[model samples]
Target: MRISTFEYFTSGVSTMNNQQASLSNLYAEISSGKSLQTAADNPLGAAQAVALTAQAANLAQYSTNQSSALTSLQQEDSTLTSVTNVMQSIQSLVVNAGNGTLNDTDRSALATQLQGYRSTLMTLANTTDANGNYIFAGFQGGSKPFNDNASGVGATYAGGPGQRQVQISDTRTINVADPGSAIFQSVSSNESSPVSSGSAANTGSGTIGPVSVTNSNDPANSSTYTITFGTTTTGTPPTTSTVSSYSVTALDPATGTTTTVTPPTPYTAGDNITLGSQTVAISGTPASGDTFTVAPANTGNVSDTDIFTTLDSLVNALKQPADSTSSLATLQNALTTAGTKISNTYNNVLTTQTAVGGREQEVTATQTAMQTTSTQTASNLSDLVSVNLPAAISQYEMTQTSLQAAQQAFAQIQKMSLFNYLSS
Candidate 1:
């Protein structure tokens, strides 16, 4: 079809304008190094990039959480290690105190050394993190977990029961620290042993020795028993004789029932007396009305599991003069109790330390997995939006050439007309 000059000229100009616009867009893409600067460029790719970017943000946050969790766990593990060392020293001292050769003065010096270790242990228990938060304070990170009690013997836990946790991944959460009560104030029931004591009010030289388990399955292991000393008199006044005897009264904790061993058993120094599942030896002549006790130390019993209190009591006992058989028995009992409690405390600390290590491993694993996913996410996001420099430069060069040719041809055509042809 025949076309007017005006229409042809307008069409030619429009084609050049379209070429310029395409060149400008390619330049922008190359300059910005992003192929999908706007959703209009590639709707699907832009949407995918958005999703990937959000995922990357979440991954970053999770990485931060993992770092924080690792820091806290590391701090706890280190502090617990120090605590275990202190406990080991204390255990050694307890064993040394039990040596028969050490005099009261030497024992007192050892007690002083134990006090130093206790102070060290207290410091370790109140350890703080990089942020100055108490590591063993459970959820009460801002509060100190343990402090000396009124008697300056043991410590009181001031923290909460629930441990602090951190989310390391989308589906995984980990404990950053253990509660002070769990670590320092509790012992496993299966690991606990009965504690024995002579009545503080006893007027006799009679003292109870360390308890030994005669039957592991006996229910009396968990029972409380009291040994009462009595006297039996017989014959005429001029030739009258008296024999010392003892009666066993047991209190069943589960049933809350009290049972007395039928008839009084004769009292003998250094003889083993069976009380339920356990046997305890009594040494030194017990006078009438003297009594001793054996009580179960169940799990979570602070009286038995508190390492600080055990140490404090042992220190006090060691400082006392063992001038009599009763005093010596008392000192030996303290040593036995302290040694057992220290061992239990050491085990508990190890268990807690293992848990912290596990958490650290979990966090490290999660971080590795997240790093892999993050790399993939970044690659996908980059592929969807990033410009390929070599390919973009090639296309840009071609477009520039095409646009220049179009403008040159338009200029040459504009010069062509009937009047110019006639003049030539």
Candidate 2:
């Protein structure tokens, strides 16, 4: 077959275009520093790079989350430490006030010191983080946890019972805070005793003197009992007898409510009425015609009182007149009970702090692992998609040489076309 001029020129043009395309691709790879510029250049590599990039981004986000969680945990740990210290100080004060040697004046002085500690503790409980959020407010960061009216009555916890947690890693979460209500204001019971007087007269039963009654033991235990006075039988010598039937009530520590029960008949003064595991004594002889009601001690509402208030109550009770023996004993028992509660609360705080620390450690481990994984993935992606610059350069040069040789051959063939050969 004889080659035509048109076909030869067309072939030469196509060869030149192929060389230009190859050169352009080589130049692009060099300029972009990538052997595979698009999916068309390296399909599998491009897909792999996309997945690797996503993994890297996720790792970055996890790193940020870890850092934030660490900061929050540190702040919480510091605040709880301060709170624990304050509680310890209060515990010491309570112990000192329990001593019988302390006179009213001495007790008053201790109470004053205790009040100062309570104020300090309140401030600590209501401490805020660097971001101005209450550390112990749980999820209610904007609200103050403890509110004191400054009336020496007690303080109240205004925050919720809910807690807040943070996700430190994929498989772990930790409680970042506990609410104020959990720390204070939940009490077992509240009891109020009112002093009253009265008179009964017919034609001539008409003389009276103030009746005095006092308590000397904790009414918290079933071993302790109370005596009540029934209507009086008038005579030269007052013939007033103790009421045989009467009820005594105390607060349930768990529910913070008063529980009442009737003692066996002939409830004598100084009889022991068992309440839970503790014992309370009722030992006040009431005048005839005077009714003395004996009831279990009430632990006020937890929201109405905190650890500080309980300590204060104990201090006040200790300061009562020695003749008010029951009141003194009740106060002593209250101190013991309140101490247990405060200790438990402090332990809980410690437990939470430990848990938070553990979570933070896990976050660190996960972050380290993720970082390693991301680095390896990124390197693998580079290997897959990135071109070897030297190799690409060599291949482009070979392709250029081939295209030039093809162009010269086409030119020689065109010159030998039949018409040009015959004219020569």
Q: What is each predicted model's overall lDDT from 0 to 1?
A: 0.83, 0.59
The local lDDT score (0 to 100) that residue 123 gets in candidate 2 is: 83
Off by over 4 Å in 1: 3-7, 203-220, 229-247, 254-256, 260-287, 299-301, 422-424
TM-score for each prediction? 0.88, 0.66
Q: Model 2: how far is 230 from its true place, Å?
A: 11
> Tens digits of per-residue lDDT for model 1 on 279-330?
9898887778888888876533585778788888888888888897767766
Q: Give the distance in Å from residue 401's predicted Cα in candidate 2 to where it truly belongs.
A: 4.9
Error of 1 at 142 (Å): 2.2
Candidate 2: tens digits of C-alpha lDDT, residues 133-153: 897787788899777757765
User: Candidate 1, residue 185: CA error in Å?
Assistant: 1.7
For model 1 the local lDDT of residue 14 reads: 92
